[model samples]
Target: ALAYAAQAFQIPCVVVIREDAQLTKLQAIRRYGAEIVLVPLAEWQQRLELEQQRRNLHLVHPFDDPAVAAGQGTVGLEILDAIPDLRTLIVPVGGGGLIAGIAVAIKAQRPNLRIIGVEPEGAPVVSESLAAGHPVAPSRLDSIADGLGAPYTRAFNLSLIERFVDQMRTVSDDAIIEALKAVAQQAKLVVEPAGAAAVAALLADAEIERPVAAVLSGGNVDMDRLGSWLTR
Candidate 1:
C-alpha cells in the first residue's frame, strides 16, 4: 500500500526494513524499483538518524503525524459508529505511534473513552517511561514482535499517551506466541506476535471488559518463526 501510494504520488521512496525481513519484501521492492535498505538491529537508530540527515527524509511519526493519526483516528470513528457505547480501547505500543494517534482521535471525539497500551515484557519502553513520568530507553529489547521492538518511545507519543492513555501493560514473549497461535488457529487470521498482543492480554485475564476493541496492527511475520510458534 505504501509503495503503491508513493508511486501514485510520484514520490521517490526507499523502504528501510530489518535485515531479517522476508525475502518476498525485498523481491517486491526490487520489482517496483524501490530502493531497499537493510538495517541491522544494533545500528537501526544510528542509521535512521543518518538517513534522515543525509536524505532529508521526511520522518512520518506513525502516531504523531496528523494525517496518519487522523487516519488511525478514523478507526475510532468507525468503532464508535458501529458500537457507540465503547468504554475502552486497547492498542499495542511500539514507538507509541499507533496508540498515540488512536488516543488523540478517540479522545477528540469521546473525551471520556479509556485508552490503554500493551507492550512486550522484554521491551517495555512505554510502561517504563510512564512509570518514570518521562520517556526512557530500555536497556535491552528482546521480543518476537519485530514491529513493537522499539528500544525507546518517542517524546510526542509518550506525552500523548501520558496525557490520554488510561493505563499500560506488558506481556511475555510466550504469551505473545500463544496469542499469535490463537489468532491464526481460532480467529483464522495470520497476525504477527505484536499484532496479537491485545488478544493475548484479553486471554490472560488482563481486566478488560467485554465489548472492547483490540487493534491487530500488522500481519508481517517470518514464515519460519510462524511455523515454530504454531508447533509450540
Candidate 2:
C-alpha cells in the first residue's frame, strides 16, 4: 500500500523482501512499481542495511518504524470517525504494529473502548510477549498467514501494545481458513489469512463486545493457492 502511495508521487521505491515469502505479496509490491530485491531469509537484515547505505536511502522498517505506526493509526481514526459508537476494535497482530498504532489512537481518545489483538496460534509472538512482560523470539513460526510470520516482536510496537492494548488472542490455522471463507462468503472480501485473523477471533469466540470493528488489513492472496485455500 505504501509502495503504491509512493508511486503516485513518483517516489523511487525499493522493497527488500525475503526470498521465501509468498509470490502474491511480491506481485503486489511489483504492481506498485517498486524495485524488488529478493534477499535470503537469514541475510535480508544485513542486506537491507547495505542496500540503504548504497543508495543513501532512508530504510523503512515494515512494522517497527514510527512513521509506519502513525500512518497505520489513520485506520483507527477513520474507524472511529465512521462509527462513533464503536466499542471494540479487533485488529490482527503480526509484529503488533497495526494494533499498536490503532491502540494508541483509539485509547488516547476513547480510553474505555476495548482494543483486542488477534494472532495466528502457530506464531503467537505479541501475545506471548505481553504475557512475559517483554519481547521474546519464538524458536519456530509455522502459520498459513505468511504476513504474520514474524518470529518475534520488537520494542517499538511491543511498548505500545503493553501500554494500550486491552487483550491479545490467538486463532488456529483451521479457524483462520474458516474466517477467510466467511469473509469471502459473507463480507464479500477476499482476504488473506493474516487479514482474516481478527475475524477468526470473532468467529471462534462469542465474548467479543458488540459494535466491534475488525480491520481486514491485507488482501494479497496467492491465486495459485486459491483452489486449495477455498477447498481446505
Candidate 3:
C-alpha cells in the first residue's frame, strides 16, 4: 500500500525487504515502481539504516508511526459502521500497529466490545510483551506467516495495545495453515497465513464471545508454497 501510494505521488520509494520474503510480495512492490533491496536477515537493520542515511529517505516505520496507525484506524471505523452491534473483534498482530489503531477506534465508540490480537506462536512478540508489561523482541522468528513475524515491539504502539486490547493469543503454524485453507474453501478468500491468524485463534478456542468479527489482514501468499501448505 505504501509503495503504491508513493507511486501515485511520484515519490521515490526504496523498500528494504528480507531476502526470504515471498516472491509475490516482492513482485507487487516492484510493480508499484519501488526499488527493492533484499537484505540478509542478520544484516537487515544495518543495511536499512545505511540506505536511509545515504539516500536521505524518510524512514516509514511499518507499525510504529502514529500516522500509519491513524490510517489503519479507518478499518476499525469501517467495521463499526458496518457492524454496529459487533461484540468481539479479532485482529492479527504483526508489530501491533493494526490492532492498536483498531482498538482505539473501536473502544472509543464501543467500550464494551472485546478486542483480541492473534500472532504466530513462533513469533510471539505481542504476547510476550504483554506478559512482561513492556515492549519485547523475540530472539528469533520461526513462523510461516512472515507478515506477522515482527522481530520487535516499541513503546509507542505497545502502550496503546496494552491499554485498548483485551487479550493476546498465539496460534501454531499448522493452525494458521488450516485456517488459510478453510478460508479459501469456505469463505472463498485466498488469504495469506498472517491474514488467517485471527481465524486460527477463533477455531482453536470455542469460548470466545459471540457475534465476533475477525479481520483478515493480508492476501499475498506465495503460490509456490500454496499447494504444499494445503495438501500437507
lDDT of each: 0.79, 0.87, 0.90
- Candidate 1: where are CA atoms >4 Å away? 22-33, 61-66
Record all residue pairs in model 1 with backbone atoms less than 3 Å apart, i.e. clashing. Answer: none
lDDT of 3 by residue, 1-232 (tens): 8899999999999998889889889989999999999997668778888999999999987898898999999999999888888899999999899999999988998999999999898999888888898987775599999998887888888999999999998999999999999998899988889999999999988898888889999989888788788887
- lDDT tens per residue, model 2, 143-190: 988788776688889999888998888899999999999998898888
Query: Residue by residue across 1-232, what tens digits does model 1's lDDT show?
Result: 4566677788877776678655645776676666777998668667766877799877644344667766676777787898888887888988887787778888988998888789988888888888888888875587877778886776777888888898898889999999999999998999878899987877787567667888898786778878999999
Flag the better candidate by TM-score, 1 or 2.
2
TM-score of 3: 0.97
Ranking by lDDT: 3, 2, 1
Q: TM-score order of candidates, best first?
A: 3, 2, 1
